[model samples]
Target chain A: MKKIFDFIDLNAEIQWVIVIILIILITATLTFQIWKKVKPSNLVDEMMLRTKSWWGMCFIFLFASLVHPIVTYLGLAFLSFFTLREIYTLLKLRDSDRTVLLACYLSIPFQYYFAFQGWYTMFLIFIPVFLFIIIPFLLVLSGDTTDIISSMCILPTSLMLGVFGISHLGLLISFPEMNTGNISGKALLLFLIFITEANDIMQFICGKIFGKHKILPNVSPNKTWEGFIGGVICSMIIGYFMGFLTPLETLPLILISACIAILGFMGDAIISAVKRDFGVKDMSDVIPGHGGYLDRIDSLSTTSSPFFHLIYFLLLA
Target chain B: MKKLILTLIYTVFWRSFNKIIIGLKYHNHKSLRKKKQFILIANHNSHMDTMAIMSAMPSKYIHRVHPIAASDFFGGTKLNKFLMKYLVNAILIPRKKANSDKDIDPIEVISKLLNKGRSVILYPEGSRGTPGVMSNFKKGIGYLIQKHPEIDVIPVYLDGIYKTLPKGTSIILPYNCNIIFGKKIDFHSLEIDDIVLKSEESIQKLIKRE
Candidate 1:
């Protein structure tokens, strides 16, 4: 239990996170009250609901980060399960794909289990290599030849995004810290999430305020070059200062922030492309106004993997 | 004792299981809010279809709701009869008669139950069909509605039940199921053909899938 406590960093850095969250929650609640009195649009209620959920998310994350490392891992595993369920729910799966879907759902727990064990080698390739071989073999055994190729194509990509991609965030906290600067697991995980999510919110706000020219009009019409630049600039500045929470130097943090900005956009765009292909406005209404977990974490699905690898290469590796 | 077991199976056990499988997407549950008795007509594909609908009914109304089960199948054996009687509160309607047995009239039984202010469940298809495909409506439902013109019919579409637990298979897959209850149909004059066609058509619209 003490070792678990040692792994978690409830230091000045995390204290700052709690303060910031409190400020944001208070400000959001006040704004909701004021906006309800002044000019309440349907959008106001939606924004209010988003803020409410954000408070829930922030507190739960803080508690998990403070309690033990295992909670964070299991929390992420739970998120991946819901996200995977959302993906499969929207997909018009064939009868042949039933076994494959079940296999994909089962892979989530195994991936996180590996993450918990700190089996980096197995965690990195479990879904892509292990489940990749196992699923197709199971499909062949089922004797349903129809829709096999498409099932093979969709299953791996969805699992990679829904299971493998999201589980990296859990793995991030479990990675061994280097002795050079002694950056704690909770602080690093919090920092990565902060930058990635801040980038998302900043982009949406900037896009709504000043966005005119569409970056990818066909794919994500809401995205604009103005919003993109603004989000990158804001996120980079935050990432540069958040170096205190991480072991990386300013230059490396800057580079990582840039990667998060571009990759986050690309990640979000790729999921937008998927939603477009499926002709769904959002994945599902699991998160009330925010659609589903997939809708909220589309950027995280892309950002977490590369960010973890970058940290690994720079410090721990 | 009978109602207790029936409520336990339908309300607690099957409801939880179906909720896990599909989250049991129930639509127009507002239609079930009224205290007035109405017959529920649904498309039958899997055995789970009945429970799926029963689970969605409010607890206040569930005690008064009785499902009309096929007597030949559900009442064929002693154990099957016990389960159907207690677990489902099923009022068995004979589909086929034995050599020595008399032809049981389902219309008489259904009318008697409806007159007693009890809501009944009926499958217009008479039996479970291939999941995702609807069979032609039998005259049994038409006869019931024609006889009891005062009882409104609630058309329900049990989507994905076939995929979850198709006919001739006991293996229950965890496929998501949706129960959509359409508006109650109260035909003015008693016409079996008109009531059956309209009831079938109403349930068809509730199905979003092909």
Candidate 2:
């Protein structure tokens, strides 16, 4: 296994991560297949659909990561675009909000461009500082100030969460410090994504099996104390072993993963609240079983920036 | 050759645009390619509606499919006429014929296309109505169905194109849209009013399905 990974053009860490993901996917497929044969239920069918989507997602993620940096940038930008578009669709913004929404969509490419150029300062402030003011101004220019406050609130937050937060993953690749030895920025990205997604899955499983006390019944009825604690612990354990992917020490790595797990939960809860407020079960049915891009990336959207900043502060800063 | 070029462009451009930008999903899309000739009726909102329907169609059937667009709207200028005729493969029929030409009938134009084994997309609403609101379908569709009872009428309910590129807006916001192709209605032995009522009800049912 080591020899084959080493022989591959990709760094051994990324190759190993890919192998681990494949093993998990295959095991899940087998487990689901067995579960279906044993007892056919809607849960099994839903899980099968989710697993199929995961396979496609894994392929796309692997392709984006393994290809040149431009592909990764473009892929991330497209994700942001889709996320923002999904949010706008869900918000049901008025025709007056169209111009502002257009401006918000246009900002995605610029945000990713900054990441591609490795313009850290500009990337950090571009959406938050620049578009923050420009969006509302554009809304004002539209001359339909009915529900302007909501537009002001939703547009900037959408950009911040969808574009600004997710663009960190792109900027992470441009860091020269992240490309140390065999573990490049791609490995770190894969590590972040794996931990974030694994934490989500862990929380879900724990909640299903051992969940009793509701955490936020109003926002998300499914989340529980058991899920949160169990997920964080499980994430920390995974992060400790996956520490080789990053340049951080063991203590910092464990702490960061815990933060990621907690933040990931917060992100999921917030998005759930937004969906519940708007009376939507899912953002959209873009992905077959996963709901939409926003549904799948809610955790990652909240985790990406924090993960990026933490790594930067610990290693680069 | 122009038709072939248009097919190629639709296969590549409109398909990709609908799939990627619009995220156009379909329900009962297989039924669309099952028939060689049919009247595809959908609620029109944006110019993207025609493109979305065309993109949903298979490339082999694209050349034979003509969306019945209004000449006054789509054929006002020479360039619009050329593009509407060639690029979109749309058969432009005048919404209101000139006083001099009393014989220029829209149904006759559509029947000619059907006679050639070509499918035509008709917006029974007659024009683009308010976004997200279904208007009363005009009687022209009923008249056409009465004349050609042999052709099947397929009701397609298009959602979210108005939000993507609504009327009075050229800038397309990338909002996901869906095309729901209802089961084909055989208007055989049905009156013009019955045909109209059935098709309208079919689309209304699709809107409720979500």
Candidate 3:
């Protein structure tokens, strides 16, 4: 125990203290949550009570799993798998669309494979050109063209943006090649997920507390302009300070994190449009307080491409 | 040999291409394709209701199911006669025919079929009412319930079929519907008149959902 304390770094000790503080916060929050459930609230109050559990669980896992590298990757991989499956459920498929659908499954391994192998070029090109070109000809050969134009527009775009676009978490983890200890990879991943997820919680709270101006009332009734700007400003300040603990540049860090925040909002809106078209709400009832696989990973889907694009230009290019 | 020949000719080739594309959903869909008998009482909308019923049920249970069709609709043409005899294997029951002395015994026939432990699908509304409302049922179905009161009643709710093939529409477009099967009901200890009233109530509850 004495020798273990001898080589302990100051920053590492601060991180440990932060982790401990988070654990206490989660425990206290959850206890109050149970109290709310037992004492019984009205309908609106009951909804907020359950939503507290959702926000609580998200933070507790994020705090604990941020330090573990392999645990974080596998966790993100499972999130990708579920979000893709939910997308598949909402969209209608034809016989000619089979090959394209199969190729969509291939992206799961390809995304993680690139992340695992630490390659950047193959990860970017695999989805855009290769999968893109191969899928349409397969549909053309089937010769069912009555809904061909509609199928071509909707199917490939849905698979690309919803499935392939969101899978850039693997690429995000493979960034930060400068650190000698191989510790920064885990730090960067944990930092990114924590900040992005915090945006979702804060926006919901802000929207409920002080929302007035409807942003896109036709599309998402709950979303307000006040919530969007509030979430962006909060995430930018959070991501900027978070970068000081790790090895990331400041100006681009805040600017890019704000961009990630806006795109995250877009990602949530796009998936909402899919649910709207089919006249359904909340894809599946798998998660209790959270809507579904699609609901949980809506923000992570938008972070992948831009975050990695910045990485390519800054580090590899 | 007969079943094999029929399966080879219709099921494998023709039914594959000719299978109707109607949306079907259920809450607990685990046993949807199972062989449990469903008295699929639906409000008659068009001449194609029985065909919709047959195609909607999975191929496993299609052969055993017998539909009670009105004598006025399928009792005239040779093609209709072949379909009623062979394809659906419908039990042709006469409607209110003008001044005919043929007193057909539907209660005894239905009771005997239920006694043989076979499930039959009958439209309890007698004939298709105007698009939405179900007409009052005739006494033959009520009498059948009185004779054999052990069979289960499954209420099937079909949507969009009225618009798909309405009364006077010649050309039909592709549409969808949901065939919901309720839980089984037992009437083993009820009186004869009570059996009729209860059966009527059970069917009415299923229709009231639409």
Instruction: Give me the candidate number with maximum lDDT.
Output: 2
Return the interface RMSD of the candidates, in order shown, one decimal each.
2.9, 1.1, 10.0
Write down the C-alpha DockQ for each prediction.
0.28, 0.76, 0.04
Best-fitting candidate, measured by TM-score? 2
lDDT of each: 0.79, 0.86, 0.62
**What ranking emerges by TM-score with the best candidate at the front?**
2, 1, 3
lDDT of 2 by residue, A87-181 (tens): 88778687888777878888888888888888888989998898878888988998987889888888899888789888989978887667666
Model 3 ranges off by over 4 Å: A1-78, A174-183, A311-317, B1-183, B186-210
Native contacts present in each candidate (fraction) = 0.07, 0.79, 0.00
DockQ of 2: 0.76
Candidate 3 lDDT score at position A97: 57
Per-residue alpha-carbon lDDT of model 1 for B1-210, expressed as tens digits? 656766687778877777764556677776688747989998888888887888877776687898899887788889998887777778898774334536667788888999899999898798886667899898778778878777778888886667666676555555445788888875755788887788888877777542
Which regions of candidate 1 fall more than 4 Å away from where they truly are? A1-11, A32-45, A59-74, A176-181, B28-37, B60-64, B71-79, B96-101, B115-117, B133-136, B159-163, B166-177, B201-210
Q: Against the true structure, candidate 3 has what lDDT? A: 0.62
**Model 2 regions more than 4 Å off:** A1-4, A180-183, B96-103
Score residue A135 of candidate 3 by CA lDDT: 62
